[model samples]
Target: MELFEMCPVCQRVCDVQTRRMGTFLSVEQLCPHCQFSRLWNSQPIVRSTPAGNLQLSTSVYVNGESFFKLEKVLKAINLQLFEYDTFLRHAKMFIEPAIVSNFKTSQEMMLRRLSEEDKIIPGGDLWADSPGHSERSGSHTTMDLKINNVVDIPLFKSDEVGGSCQMEKEGLERGLALLQEHGCLDDLMALIFDENFVDPAPFKEEILKVTITEDLCAQDERPVKEEVIESFVTQVKTEAF
Candidate 1:
């Protein structure tokens, strides 16, 4: 504000017009004394997008931070910032699409590796948005137990599947479909499930249930569900050879 008070060319006090968008600032000075005019930008523009605007969107999405939370902080300090609609537009138009594209590229590489295997014993689990039956959404993750790499993750909303309890089954179905779509289902030898998983009746022949006893938990020192699945995989591999 102080720097813009006096025009540099004319060396006289002048009125400056300022525009702010998120972290980007633009200042235009038009001095009446010498008719000097100048426009300044705080940051560079990338394509049609302001660099600061894109950066803010990228940082918020990648760090798992919500725009509303940041908005509250900015409001408290009376700082100039973009609106929620603009953030949402940036996320939908840029952030989420790029994330999905990158994920697909990585997922295809993993699927190729899994396809080359003679047998794939993938571990599957469902994570609810909350630790309860009435959670709004859930995601099922399928990991290749042999290499300990994630193969697929399918997210489901409760409303889409009737209820939160139904999310697990829906997610598992979607995960299996993903594997099938990628031609990796043929090599699937067995599917391991966590303690919470039940009703393997749909795919009982390929299901291997492993429980993480207290001793097993103490020995593995990993997440209880993952340790149980990996222990099952280890035992299967040992017996096969």
Candidate 2:
């Protein structure tokens, strides 16, 4: 619904709309005064005012950057009753499921599109442990040599991927398991990995088709084969095969 009123943030009359789907509520209000746009990702709660008018208000927990704005507003207004840190953490609990659901949907769609293409190759990456992390994280993504469109598969911290040093093989094995779990066919033209990367023995036939690119420098001290693939995959992400 569109509303004609002064914006609370910029104090200008503008058109505002509120939409709700399932438990998710979105409020978009643009300020003509400062040309600033405000979006609120919240969950709705219905209550009756003293005047008997039904009013909708979001709880302290909300998603994304707008939630921080709400905190700023509260501080500006000298409201100290709310627990900012607790609510901040709770908001993530509310938002992570939706993020996961959306990611799965996108992955399925990408896989479907890739299945239709005959020339696309499947490759993976074995990243060394990242900073501020205790374990190494290795993962794989789909690469389309035809259009060079790389569809990245989001890897969560909890995802079964292992460290590149010791867990490289385990990481690749987990990646293949996920592919089979998704019902992906063995239509991949080639599997690419680092030269000394451990073999995924479970899928030996599938692993036999693995391709290793020569390192430009010494070829021996070269980075893992999947390193190049991972870099390119990170550079370009598109659904088009």
For candidate 2, the per-residue lDDT at 199 reads 69
lDDT of candidate 2 over 128-159, digit per residue (tens): 44644455453455444455654554343324
Each prediction's Cα RMSD? 16.2, 19.9
Candidates in order have lDDT scores of: 0.81, 0.53
- lDDT (tens digit, per residue) of candidate 1 on 87-148: 88889988899999998899999988777776676678999878978799878898887878
Candidate 2 least-lDDT 10 residues? 48-57
What candidate 1 gets wrong by more than 4 Å, as runs, is 2-15, 32-35, 75-78, 129-136, 146-148, 157-167, 189-241
Give candidate 2 misplaced runs (Cα > 4 Å).
1-82, 85-89, 126-164, 180-241
Top candidate, metric TM-score: 1
* Model 2 steric clash pairs: 136-163, 194-225
Clashes of each: 0, 2
Question: Candidates' TM-scores?
Answer: 0.62, 0.38
